[model samples]
Target: MKLPKALAFDVFGTVVDWRTGIAEQAAAFLARYMPGTDPGAFADDWRNLYQPAMEECRSGRRPFRLLDALHLETLVQLLERRGIGTAAIGEGELLDLAYAWRRLRPWPDVPPGLAQLRKLFPVVTLSNANIALMIAMNRFNGLEWDAILGAEVSRSYKPTPQAYLASAAALCLDPQDLCLVACHHSDLAAARACGLQTAYVDRPMEYGGARAPDGSYEQAWEWRAGDLLELVRVFTSH
Candidate 1:
């Protein structure tokens, strides 16, 4: 099948190594602020809260909140749970730590693949990350993006049709004209349900290879590749 006119990517695990990036930042911050915390496990714990936090809004338990605000709230709760009181960690320190999400390192293939992919299609993000967070990460990591369109734009998180549909609307394209490139099956499945094309990028090490992907790739998808470079090749070759 021919590719779509625009590509919207899932930024977290698809484009960047969040685990290592968060662990590194947490290590640097906690070493000076709160000693004896395992940085890697700490990173995992923080990420572990991502879905449920978003679910609060998704389930309509709370109004739409930016990922940045969720991150801050989660961090404060985590610190207190670890017995690191607010007095021990000031507001400035908490804010700095929460902003670590903006400093993630890209997967090795990301920059080159995105640079090449941009030549063929209008490439933008469809992440749950807020607009400011996305912009900061792109500038910090030197990613090539035509626009940032995602949860913040729609005020709706992924798997919700609004997030995907809103992204297409932002670019003034039909949902069918846009492809959602992601490492998570649930993400692509949701996009497919909304009539958008799906491209799966295999990131076996997204969770440090500790867990397998949700299922086999037996279902039909527009494209699947081992990495972004491979996805770029698939697009260019067809």
Candidate 2:
């Protein structure tokens, strides 16, 4: 396979371990705000609302909202469902908790893999995370990027062609000259449909120890590997 000039990554589960970060933070928050509840379950609950909230904007059911806003909305609903008073949680801490997505830790393999890939090709993030949130993650985790381009830049979400095209355009590259590397098959499929190349990196722990990812190298994709380090082996050899 010919190498592309640039690579765009899916940030959340693909680049960082959101489940662990969210669960730990949620546990700390719950210890103070609500006692004896399971933080890991709460993390899953918050994430479960992620796609549906974005779909509201993607389908035009609501005006475009940043991913931060969607995370807040879902957090509020979870609070209410748990019988915790949203007002009692207070506005400031509530906002901070919602933005916890910005503070996720990278997978153990991310730093070395991204560093190697950056040497091989221009690497930027292509994610549903809003720009501010993505930047915070970059700073928090020290994941250097050549550029950050995603839903905020395009005013669209993943699985939407506009987002992928906008990301490639931001780098002054054609769709085929950019590859979308992600843990989610749906995201890669969308990028493929938009004429961008696709690479699948398995993240079995993305859902924490409770669940496993759905796809394997057995599926048809332009590239498949255990992790980003393995991808480095592929592109660097070419």
Best by lDDT: 1
lDDT of 2: 0.88
The TM-score measured for candidate 2 stands at 0.95
Q: In order, what lDDT does every prediction score?
A: 0.89, 0.88
| Weakest lDDT window of 10 consecutive positions for candidate 1 | 210-219
> In model 2, what are the clashing residue pairs, if there are any?
none
**RMSD each, Å:** 1.7, 1.7
Candidate 1 global CA lDDT score: 0.89
**lDDT (tens digit, per residue) of candidate 1 on 120-220:** 89999999999899888878998979999999999999879999999999999999999999988889989999999999998888777767445653357
What tens-digit string does per-residue lDDT give for candidate 2 at 68-182?
9999999998888888888777799999899899999999999999999999999998989888998888889889999888999999998899999999998989999999999
Output the number of the TM-score-best candidate: 2
Tell how far residue 123 is off in model 2, in angstroms.
0.4
